[model samples]
Target: MKKVLIVFVFSIFMILIFTVDFPIKGDSLYGKYVNTNYQNTICCVEAPHEPDTLILFNDGKFESKFYGKGWFEIYNGISPRIQLHYTSFGKAALFNTYFSNKFFEKTKIILNADMNHTYTKID
Candidate 1:
C-alpha cells in the first residue's frame, strides 16, 4: 500500500510539472514583435509604414495594424513553425523560425517567408 501511494504521488507530481505553466522556450514568442527591416523586405516601392509591428498574445491570438487580427499556433520543439490565422478580412501570414532557449532569451525572433525578416521583441 505504501509503495502504491508513493507511485501515485510521483505520477501526480509529474503531471503537474508538465501541465502547469512550466516555462518553455516557446513561451518567449508571446509579446510584441516588430519587423526590423520593413523597407527592403517588401517588394512594394511605396511603403505604408516604416516598420511593421505584430503582437502575439498568450491566448493564442495575434494582431497587427497592417495585417489584421487572428489566431496563431507554433509547432515543433525549440525551433518551431508558426502559423497565423487571420480572422479579419484583410490578410493572413505565416512565419517560420528556429529559436533555442538561449537565443529566445535575447527576445529576438527571425521569421522567414519569401525573405528572412528579423523581429525584435519590445515588451
Candidate 2:
C-alpha cells in the first residue's frame, strides 16, 4: 500500500511539473520589438506620428518610443497573452493592452493591440 501511494504521488507531481502550462521566462522575451507599419491614426485619442517600437527587459520592465515605460506580464495557456501596462506621455495613453501572442516562434512574434502587427525580435 505504501509503495503504491508513493508511486501515485510521484506520478501526480511529475504530471503537474511537466504538463502544466508554465509561462516563458522574461529572458526569452527580452529584446526590442519593432512595428514598422503601426498606425494609431484611427484611434480616438491622438498618438505619435512615428512608428512604435517596444523594448522588453529581463526584469519585466518595458519601454517604447511612444508608449513610455511600464511593467509587462505574460500568461501562458492555449492562447498565450502578453499584457503591456504602459503610460504614454502624449494623448495616446493606454493603461494596459492584452497583446495576443499570435505567432511566437523564436525571433518573430505577432501582436495585436487593435489590429494585427507583426513584430520581429531584435537584440
Candidate 3:
C-alpha cells in the first residue's frame, strides 16, 4: 500500500510539472500587468486610451473596465492562449498576446483589435 501511494504521488507531481508549459497552466501569466501596456513588438502601436483597464486574477478569473463598461469573468487564463469568459456579454473573447522584440527588455501585448489606446507602463 505504501509503495502504491508513493507511485501515485509521484505520478501526480509529474503530471503537474508536465502540464505547466501546456498553456492551460503556464506560470508566467499568474501575476498582475496593471498600468502596463502590452503592445505589439513590431510597431509597438498604442492608442492614447488603449487598454483602459484589465485585471486578471490567479484563480482563472478576470475583471476589466473598457469603454466605461465592466467585463467580468469567473474563469479565465492567459497561458497557451489568452481567453476571457465575459460574464457581461455572456461570451468568451480570445485575445492573442504579443511580446516585445527587445532582447533584454520585454513587454506583453493584449490586443482587442485596434491598438488605439495603449501606453507605456506608468509605474
TM-score of each model, in listed order: 0.55, 0.53, 0.37
lDDT of 3 by residue, 5-121 (tens): 999999998876654433323444444444343443434322213345555555766555641222323223334334444433554444344322222332333353264223222
Of 1 and 2, which scores higher on lDDT?
1
Local accuracy of candidate 2 as per-residue lDDT tens digits, 1-123: 999999999999987665443444546667897764456444434233467777988788888876688887776565456667765554434343333332233343444445544465666
Q: What is the lDDT of residue 16 in candidate 1?
A: 62
Q: Give the residue spans of candidate 1 off by over 4 A.
A: 1-26, 41-49, 87-105, 112-116
Tell me the deviation in Å of residue 58 in model 2: 0.6
**Residue 89, model 3: Cα distance from true site in angstroms:** 4.8
Better of 2 and 3 by TM-score: 2
Which pairs clash in model 2? Answer: none
Ranking of candidates on lDDT, top first: 1, 2, 3
Task: List, residue by residue over 6-53, the lDDT tens digit for candidate 1.
Answer: 999999988765543322355667999877665554554222236677
Candidate number with the higher lDDT (1 or 3): 1
Model 1 clash tally, residue pairs: 0
